[model samples]
Target: MLGQGLVDVFFEDGLNWEADLLEDTRFVMVETTAYFEAYRHVLKGLQEIEEGQFPFEKYIIACENEVSPPKYLRNRRTVQFDLRPLVDENIVIREDEALRRQRRIVNYQFSAESRCAESVEILNLRSWPRPDQLHLDQSQYEALQTALTKEFVVTQGPPGTGKTYVGLKIVKALLHNASIWNSGHQSPMLIVCYTNHALDQFLEGIDSFFKGNIIRVGGRAGEDMAKHSLKVKKQALRKLQDMRQIAGVRFNCTKSMMEVKLEIERSGAQMEASEREILHEDMLRPFMDNCYDQMTCVELPQQQEIPSMMVEWLGLEQMLGETQVAVQQGREDDNLHDKQEDEIALSKRICNASVRLSTVTTKFVNPTIVLTTMPVHESSLLTSSNTTSVECHGQQ
Candidate 1:
């Protein structure tokens, strides 16, 4: 039985299936949550298409061309892929609702008022680093610029034309302008790749530029990325905070013991209770002060003055920055150790370009800008499917 669902299996020719299953045999099943979500999204998209309510009205497919097969095949035909967009007036696209929905998405995604003209102007006015200093060649620069300014952009390039490189630049630019473009709401960006390796590589690249919260939904991350993973980071931070809390409790316990002693002194033999209580408190003060000095970790400010949760958050933020720096340093060391001469030279070139870019794009690469605007507490990104080109999950 799989969960609550059951199925019956039949053996052929009286074969003993149990005999084939050894005592040490094991079965591993993977969750299909991502696949199921994709499937459900595809069904919704198809339903919308059937109802003539699909978006992207301009790209609707028209008629298909069929041709007979060659002499080698008997009574066979194939559909030619010379497909064209439907432009007939008879085929009307219902776009009013789609437009409204798109507007809402734009507003939420940008955290702005959805002023396209203003946004375009903002993109245009950006003082990008000098083309000569950027790592990208002319074509790459043009592609990156077009992607930044246009509402819809499709970049086509040959294999070695730095598509991924330009993509990383675009991500950086968008993250930098997250607050300015959205005015106040900084929507998270979603990146989808075909394989886990590609995703890990892309995320690692993001980590190089931005030191903020990152939650990787799926698994099979590389060993080097363990500290960067969401689960590991959270656990490490929580463990540190727990230690601090325990220390605080121990210190509080010491104080409480002193208070109990003073109370006992006040309840002394009826003659000199008040004077004894005063003497007891005075004597305990020095020892309590020593205890406070020893338990320095617990000498936190009062909660009313400085909340414990805020302290934990500040500690986490500082650690995250240090972690990113360490990760970057480790990467640099690894490159120095393992890189060939050509790779080392190329890396130097990229570093020079990055330094130049930083002069003009410092605001965009600032971690504070991205973290303050982007709601990391929410589900940041929803990746699409691998098999088909259909957009999958929406913002949660």
Candidate 2:
């Protein structure tokens, strides 16, 4: 009777499978013998699933089975399937673990013998140093002290509470202690932020004090100021810089002064006055002589005589002739100015441009503090040393 029942269930499952297969538009009906032959051809149609394309349902199924499904099935449309059993099993396990953790936390909280409990009793919170430099409030000072002494501390407050400020002080104190403990060796510190904007703000706040000791990873906006960022590693940045230099040089050599002046004027509103001045002084003036030294340098096709009516309406006849005369006159005195000042300014810009790329490439050579959006605890920079990691998050 049991064997007959098992056979009935097997047939029922097969019929359900057949119905599902038929419902799916991707599958077609075939004779049982022909199906085996078609399978070989169908397998050839399978393509590898790209990363991040896996559906939520398929992910859950994969997790439940504890095995990866075939690549072809990964992209298939999800069917209505009951996941209650797997979900229930996970919920039960998690609930039990939560209960266990709750009991542990309760014991730790109430037990007089616990180290944290003992610290609260013996430590004089009032005696904690209030550094004049940090200008911490009473609440922030208490929070800082607790964080420094305890293994785990939760500091919570509403917005604009100086949480980040106090946390940075705590980090500074810990770094000083670590350096002493490690016999004058600078200790590595990893600072994690919730967002790239926060990371930039934090780095900017401490940049003067830390100077070359800080390295920032991720985000393109902070690249130039932070000295280190992941954007520096991209080949595109290097290429763009090279192209800019080439274009600057080419614009000086190829284009006439009148044409260049018109181009600059058209885009002048978008550029800073200082930047416009630099372009005129460093790039345009130096190359102006080369541009107009030879009349043959004009690359444009010869224009026919302009109509009197159009020239009067446009007022281009005088402007165009005057621009040519100015260029010729300016070429005479081009060699009279000092080239040293321009060279110095150009060198400074080049140095500033390469700083981020150089810093990111050589960051691991020394013990340094890193500011990043996520914790890079597994990085060799942290793992190789006795590093202290501090995570700070807030609305500010």
Candidate 3:
């Protein structure tokens, strides 16, 4: 019931539950043909049923281990369990030896009859999702190891080194641990990624592992599934704008809680702006003497000496140069050109440059770099009076 993807269903007619010579009325005797050979739980299971007080035989036929013997160890495991009358809690506990049992579990509440086993016709074990363990390419795997050990991690990266991908993996690791989810902890782990695409990748990874457990705030800023990253950017930007309202207001904004509410009240627009500012400032703290590209090692408490580096060349100075160039070329820096000629030319260049940056970031973002789309950063004017409304979903 837990894992439903790969299922191996075997059907045998005339498996009479009532007609049995194997000597147990409680357990409708299953022939050796029904059992899996090569090494057995069902065999040992039969003995356990006779010794144990509970009528496990009734559940034995109904029981399915999510992962089971030979098939899972070698090939994929896809064993489906067919229950006649659904149980109250359909948790199929898997023995460490096997974990391939499964059930589609549509509506488990409609049945309450005691004679549930009388109706089971066949058994199935399945796993539709290929056994592709979250394959993080070399870089991501490395980052994952580092993130697990470090309390605070900052991967100062350029276009790629799997920054977002690596960050998502850390989330995956946290969620994967049962203790973390059950901890009742607050303060949602913050992930201020580089771009819309990077955020999407993070969300996608999160969804793949956590299902629908997370709540994404700030939508209602754009519409266009094809441009999801762009829309997300607009949503955050709009939130940041709302936050700016609190900038000069007399309200108490020094406290973290107070600032959080103020930003939330302003629709989280300023948060996006702040995130952008962080990335802009990612190059270095202004006027500080340290290079952003290099990461140094800290000494271990027990050792007299220190590890040379936790990470080699963690920072990417190239991002600084590229970002500066792009910012210089941005429409934000251009003069207010009233002439039609200058407007047209400026619009063309901005649009072209945005597109180029979007494309460049796409490849980097996939292998997991954060990136903003062309339209998110700048827009071409269809008309001077254009008042376009980008309405993204999931925002009330």
Per-residue lDDT over 1-396 for candidate 1, one digit per residue giving the tens place of the 0 to 100 score: 767665445565589987787766656555574666656666666866754465433343432233222222233242111000011112111213354445532222231222222223323334444344445688887886676554446688788777877787777655544433443344556787778798888888777765555667567887756667778877989999999999999999999999999888755643375454223323344556765344334455464322223234335535655766899999998887776776888988876654211111112343442212222333334333321121223222
lDDT of 2 by residue, 123-202 (tens): 34443333332356778867865665444355789989987777666654443233222332344567777677888877
Off by over 4 Å in 3: 1-139, 185-187, 194-197, 219-396
Model 3 CA lDDT for position 225: 24
Worst 10 residues of 2 by lDDT: 86-95
lDDT of 1 at 371: 18
RMSD of 3: 40.5
TM-scores, each model vs. reference: 0.38, 0.27, 0.22
Ranking by TM-score: 1, 2, 3
- lDDT by residue for model 3 (1-396), tens: 328644343434556544544553233335565336633654566656554464433245555434233211234333222322212223222212122124222222333442342232112212111112234565555555445433334465787666765665556445433232333334455555445555555666565545323444333322322333445657777989888777635355456668788868765664566575433333233433454333333333573332223222334445655666798777554544446668799999876654321111222433564543323334332222322233222211
Residue 327's C-alpha lDDT in candidate 2? Answer: 92
Model-by-model lDDT, in order?
0.52, 0.47, 0.42
**C-alpha lDDT (0 to 100) for residue 372 of candidate 1:** 20
